[model samples]
Target: MPDKDRSQRVSDAVHHRRWLILTILLFSLFVVVLDNSILNVALKTIAAPPPTGIGASQSELEWAINSYTLVFAGLLFTAGLVGDRVGRKGTLLCGMVVFGLGSLLSAFSGSPGQLIGFRTVMGLGGAFVMPATLAIIMNVFERAEQPKALGIWSGAVGLAIAVGPITGGLLLEHFWWGSVFLVNVPIVITAVIAMVLVVPDSRDPHPGRLDPLGVLLSMGGLVLLVYGIIKGGQLASFGSPLVWATMLGGLLVLGLFVRHELRVENPALDMRYFLDPRFSAAICAVGLAFFALMGVTFFMVFYLQSVLGHSPLQAGLLLLPLAAAQMFFSPRARLVVDRLGTRVVCGGGLFLVGLTFLGFLSLDTASDPWLLCLLFFCQGVAMAHVMPPATVCIMSNLPRSKAGSGAAVNNIFRQVGGAMGVAILGSLLSTSYRHGIEGHLRVVPRSQRDTAGESVTATLAVAQRLGPAGRALVQPAKDAFVHAMHVTAVGAGLAAFLGAAVVLAFLPGRGRGPCADDDRATPGSPPATGRDEPDL
Candidate 1:
């Protein structure tokens, strides 16, 4: 056969397999997102008192959420590099196995500490799986199909978020809290089998050497940075020597890591990606969007369960509109971006997010639940617009050779943003709640006052245990929680609006300059070049 005919045959084979591979990848991605959002509903069951609950504290509840994202974010850069060096498909399979094992162990964890530890293990697996999916998508699809492909991929995320809570709610209604973790096992097994059989193996031809020092610095820096931020918020004092020292040391180390990466031959992440205006803007939009989304979610689930006194299933049902709106809008985001340009679409999305958050400020204990649902629906639509376009913008800016790194970069910001959002906004709520209840708390017995002031969950428990004596504590605590949520919503709205302003100022408009096309893999491909940004 002629060389041309053979090449055509290989191309045809790859094209035939692409959509099948995408199906497997989407399923894998859905499971990861499912596990993430499902935890929100389960946290209440895990922490509440009784045979059904473990009686964990507020801090423990926060850790149960944050630990996974923290470790996942820290390890992502290293995982992406490994995937590029090895095969992406093999890396994904390894990740799925580990994730399944972690989930199995998590199902049996006897204490909060054990659960958190196993969650970190799942995060390690997630680091491998997350980057490989997007990297594979970039490799398999042509540029013309990328925006549509990404929309579908983003839609899977919306679907997972929609499905996770309902699934968790149903399990908690019928089974134990451990059932949530156990559910991932079968799904992961199916994903692994399908992926191995259908997905094509791809890796960088010149992956170069691993950057051990860069990896160490980045991981350590992110962990310390997030740790310090969480502590600063919880401890309620930036003046604390430990807080300042940890935060400053983390910042200094991150600075050094950037300097080192610039000097090294094989940087884990190419720093040059930031020089693209679209790349930087896309990353920031994703980060800011998640920052607001996670902060609100961290609080909303608790509000529904603890404040509104709804059952787990009811709360999950209430959140359904969010998923519905996201699924409804995300697939159509590409059309909006094409018509209005990324700047208008993304900026408009953030503005909508801000508007809905502002709307949340009006929510009181007496406000209708459907009003909250309406706000959630709007926010979901806003997120759909922001995420897909931002994803496209970031992937479009990168060379295909750097797809693994690019995907890692994109996810890292979103994860870090989520972790930070929880830490910061949660702290604000805690602070305000304490302050609001302080005068009222003084009327209670000193012993009961401290316990009641700890959290809404604790206050409710104390109220139940003490009967009428603790009854007075309930109204005050509920009032404080509502007030705190209002303040936090206002702050979140401001942040979303700020993100929109930044994107409008910096992100390039459509057809304004030279854009780099996605790099198609060919043997001995040359390094890609683009118009560099002006120096800082």
Candidate 2:
């Protein structure tokens, strides 16, 4: 009776502090995810000359962005495994320190290469921090409260993504371009201190020996795949031998990695988890949702700035509706899932996202800003609905022991999807833009025509150089860009719709319990943990 009372008191203490712990975790998560998009608004400043900018070349600027993403995505799986083997709280703390130091170094970087190197360090830190947040949440929250905790966590991430540009724009307005990276330092420091006080150490109880071969295969495959994707986007063609070779090689290596893991005594990732329908369907849903969102946002920044004549600050403010809707609806999404189940909520959310993408097709230079804001709000609503439910589904399906690994794989899908979407959509945009304007530029000199056909920014620059004679090129260039935006929007919409279809077909219906369909197990399936059916 005395021991029972002691246990009850301990439980009460933990439960009392849960929300505080969650706040710290969410803040940590915010910084890591913010890094992914914060640099978007700063890239131009970083490439400009003067005390305010670093004068990086265009290619260097691209590398500055891609380097962080490539390293972050490639190292995520390994980070997750490491966190699971080590303690998640310790990993989170170390990650925060590294990330803060990296940001400080980035602010002091003399050249673009130095800044890029610092960003890579930041990415390495983020890989550790991201998975640890999810894993900690999975460990701390009770099953009944998991959805609510996850909802808040997901909302925080969505909010960070939405607000990242605004934060960058505001910083750049008053400070040097390096301030964007520097802003992370104070926030990370605060979170690191809070985490140490409130968060508990958690790790896999029976983490087996590391799989070096699996590690090599997975890391190499991801790095090569991302490199191929980025290279393909830059060249605007998958026809390049280097692109195909790298992508194919990455795929082959990943296949071998999976095979080796299945045969090994202690695999890095348990392949059996993929056999579960809920896990598989949820992964697909999250991947497609991010792919569309990332692709749209990538081009939308350019469109608002280059075509609509909005300042970076104005563009950032314009995106507020999207962010607002995401934050407002995400915490409520789990409720919708409770009533409708993952199948309906996830499928319907993606369907709505697709519709919103299609709505962009109707936009023109003269279109109302309010109208665009409404569309963005709708897109955000769809995203809010999709992500929380998908996240809950994925996390709930995995046993507590492998939550870190599961979270890593879930994020891997998102990162890969974002990378692919950006590459493919950017290629489509370039192709359509070039085809539209190349014919119109034939009357100009070959060099000037080639310059004008390169990009809308180039066309505008070339037009300025031509003075009044370039007036003929201005409207045509904008028109070509609008045309490309339409084509890309349609393609993005199609991908989302197809993903929704896959979710509907593969995901079990509403009446099925969480583990009800586990009877059709693989040869080496582990016993079910009897997780609740998400209050549906």
Estimate TM-scores for all models.
0.93, 0.93
lDDT of 1 by residue, 1-536 (tens): 24444332234555567788788999878888889889889987898665677777767876776678778888887787777778788888998899889899988888889988999899889889999999888777666667778888887887787678889999998999999999999999999998877787766667678899998898888877877777766664557788778878878888989999889988887787777777888899988888888888878877888888888788888888888888888879988877778888888999999999889888877668889789888888998898888898888777666778778888888888877777788778888888887887655677777777766777777778877877887888888899999998987888899889878877666665313443422223354332111111
Model 2, residue 433: distance off in Å is: 1.1
**Model 1 residue 351 distance off true place after TM-score fit, in angstroms:** 0.9
Each model's RMSD to truth, in Å? 4.9, 4.0
Q: Which candidate is the best by lDDT?
A: 2
lDDT of 2 by residue, 189-233 (tens): 899888877887777767778898999899999999998998898
